[model samples]
Target: MSQSSQFSLLSQRRFAPFFWTQFLGAFNDNLFKTALMVALTYDALSWTSLDPGLLNNLIPGLFILPYVVFSATAGQIADKVEKGRLARFVKLLEVAIMLVAGIGWMTHTLWLLIAAVVGMGVHSTLFGPVKYAYLPQHLKPEELVGGNGVVEMGTFVGILLGEVAGALLVSYRPVGIELVAGASLTMALIGLAASWRIPASPAPAPDLRINYNFVAESMRNLRFSAQNRTVFLSMLGNSWFWFYGALVLSQFPVYAKDYLHGDHSVFVLLLTVFSLGIGVGSLLCEKLSGRKVEIGLVPFGSIGLSLFGIDLYFASQAYTNTALVDAFALLATPGAARILVDLVLIGVFGGLFIVPLFALIQTRCDPQHVSRTIAGMNILNALFMVAAAGVAILLLGQGFSIPDMFLVTALLNAVVAVYIFSLVPEFLMRFLAWLLIHTIHRVATVDVERIPDAGPAVLVCNHVSYVDAIVIGAASPRPIRFVMDHRIFKMPLLGWIFRTAKAIPIAPAREDPFMMERAFIDIAQALHEGDLVCIFPEGKLTSTGDMNEFRGGIAKIVERSKVPVIPMALRGLWGSVFTRDPGNLFERSFSRGLRSKLALAVGMPVAPQEATPEYLYEQVRALRGEWK
Candidate 1:
């Protein structure tokens, strides 16, 4: 297995089925909901309640209620059952629910249709844990970012499609209600077919007994999540995102109609822009982070969310009556560019904010307990969404315009972000670490292309600085899972970044025999599964700024796995701030550069049969342009 093939999108079976399953599910969900909402909104006079606003508010509440009520139990069920089976069952439930929705549509029964919406919410709550937990199981740690990217993209695009389909189909009065009912049924059936194809994911804990006490079990799940401070904080940050998103998005219809003076089409246009922005941002995450779960992007996302959110308020203020405007008209309006920019940036930052957090939760949580932990997070997400509605209602009651609510939410986002980052400095800390390497240092490469473009390969690099892993990470086009010393894995801020990056922590036999063995086994499994496994062969940082004796660990790994070994060298980093060399505390001259030139050189791959420490050493030193 080569490094390139390890990270290739189409090569892995772990991802594709799950991707389509979730995508179709999301698409169907939005399609049904949007169609219902549009029907209710446009034909309010024909419905029982003349107040479209009240029905709108009530619908979201009804949908979210199930998440709050059932998520904890759903988590437990997912843990105890085979995830693939569970997913199929849930999709089947979706078909049944949509059928009920179709009946309601045909009969013009709003309440029955609303019940179906609630059912879909429950379906989503149950599927939520399975959706996230399944990823860590099948995906290599290195593929987490890209896999999540695709999932996120599919989800948003599905939402956009659903919204468009719902609005358009519900408005089409061909044969009164028959056409809408038929369209809904067809989409639901297609979604079920997609779900059926999800490959078998064996249950993680088949012997686990069911916990019927929802409150107590829910509390237990939350407490279990709290045990990992970073994971818990990530959940909180994630919840905050839902809170922010719900508040902003809930007002879109109003903003479009009241402020932009457009019809439902404008509402759809706004949603399409936002959803497309998220898809683009999500896909870009893998490229930007070098295919790692880079938490640094979280703060970057937060900053953009706040800045663009504030700017959106000003843009809205500049809008005059612009009703019935198509996408082009919206673009050409006086403040249109700013509004569009803000919406797109919000989506971009939202993607940045979300993808890493999901990866962090997946990688950091106990695998056995991950599904339940996600369930707890879903519960919080439900609460936040509910709270968003409550807040919006209160603001509207106080005579605030929808645009004003957007501004308030944007400002509040800044405050919440600052508070959360202050509490859990890992987000800010990773930002610092990411900044240090990318800005002050310009890493140059010689023979980087020597690293095999595909197949399983072991990277043996001479460790020099604390950030050796990050340097290698930045240089490689593909993601590499590092096998690091356990002690370094416990480093203050650096430890969190490494863990989130899914770097496997190892110890020498003398320190922790069991952990060491597990590390080696994991390495072998990763290789057999065709993943890039990188190790600092010197085992520890070079105290004298020179390569140390290469351990036989790399040799042993290759002997067992028969993977190629790519030797790498680092230079121009011996006296940097991260290095061991003593320097003036306040007047460090080495770290002060806009882009300091650094080098990462790669040597030709040594076959498993021919690899030797002495030969690889000479190759690395030669590539480094120096000898010691």
Candidate 2:
């Protein structure tokens, strides 16, 4: 059954407890971490003589170090142990760390607080695999995107509120340290209470031998994940976001204080808008993706990230304010809102870029080894984030302003995005198809989930327009290898996309028997390898905006492959620009206007024995109805 919204999950036992646990963990971690950061930045003499600027970068770097050192073992433990029990233990550790941090607050022991930071880092590292791997066990496949979206939204909201709470609490008069410490301990206990309610998730790999040598096991985890090309690239892509985010977020305090000459509240404002932007974008993923893991958003997001990031540099450079002020006073200054907008957009786009990738990684990686794969991604994130800190430190050392780092990172983001997309053309190809459906057409799918999520299946659909494949691809949860007529498949712009999508082009036997035979061989091969291959059994687009004669090719292919054939039909696309409408291109498109409503209705899967061309033709015709 399709879930109404990602928020529906919060009401269920399976999801709510897990959500609260994760939310609280993020809140506690950031609350303490940000409180420490604010104290150091605004009250530096009491903390240490270390450059507050340098400490800002170094602190985040310190927090991620445990991800490098402990992720392998953590992944193994998560894979081998019951997740609910482990979560409780992790939360218990948080409580202990908070106890230590409470002492740091009361005694004014900077070293103790710093150690608590590292301890909290260890807590997060252990929880990382459990957090992601837990969802796949609980949620349905269709719910993965929405589930992930809600989790991300909750996490960032937690981080945002925590940062805000921490910033506000630490700066309180008379007993600021006491307030911060008390709140941290209280949150840690609440998180532990939440953990007890999490439903039990059995280990996928109970026999996984725990490896104590973190370094060797970490390499093994990386090597294992590297075996899957797409998954590995996605891991790298996921890590790159962290690199970009760390670079941006780490600079906010200094940027607020030194550049904008603003008080701590100004720093809180930056964190507020940016995290809120991410929360909004993350929740939108479910709606934008039609509840599927739509990775096309990755490219779309990267474009915005670079555009706004570049603008952020210019926005800051344009600001002339130098008087020290709080957030409200800073808002009154010229050019400040632009900086806020840029940061918000950057966060929004970052959400768009990341949430789908997380869903993709979860859905794509080996089921029994999800934790380890996540560990591999975490390792990459740690390395990249550490690199972000090092690079920022180097830039600042070389006399680069905070805005200079923004410009450099923004430009580098563009380069990195292009490089990753080039390596995986699927990202770019899906983006084009997604753009078409979202901008020009609004698509609804009927009984589409009847198509199997895995294994071999033959998709036979009526060809209604030139973009039938693109439309179908846009609606599908999985990539479909479309088999198109050689002529239409070779059209200029469409041809480029077809090639990138690895669409197979076939000619009629009368024209080129060799190509026809080769196409069948390719179809059989794809099915044998367990892929979804969609073919237009109508053999050609209907000239009258109706179903064409059923070609015998579908029967022959089904007989050979012995796989279920899903009969589908496109409706309400007959007079669209790509169709054989009785009008010029401009006229046909103008008639359709924007966001034209179209539907792809899929019927029950026909067994190989029952899937004759005639039977399948009637099935598709029935599904399409007279909408065309």
| Predicted candidate 2 versus true structure: per-residue lDDT over 1-628, tens digit per residue | 3358778899999999999999999999999999999999999998799999899999999999999999999999999999999999999999999999999999999999999989998999999999999999999999999999889989999999999999999999888999999999999999999999999999999988899999999999999998988899999999999999999999988898899998889999999999999998898888899989899999999999999999999998999987888999988899999999999999899999999999999998999999999988898999999999999999999999999999999999999999999988899989998999999999989988987889999999999898999999988889899998899765799998998888888999999999999999999999999999999988988888978879899888988999999999999999987888776888886878899999999999999999989999999999999899
Clash count per candidate: 6, 0
Alpha-carbon TM-score of each model against the true structure: 0.77, 0.98
After TM-score superposition, the amount by which residue 462's alpha carbon in candidate 1 deviates from its true location, in angstroms, is 8.3
Residue 363, candidate 2: C-alpha displacement in angstroms: 0.7
lDDT of 2 at 205: 95
TM-score top scorer: 2
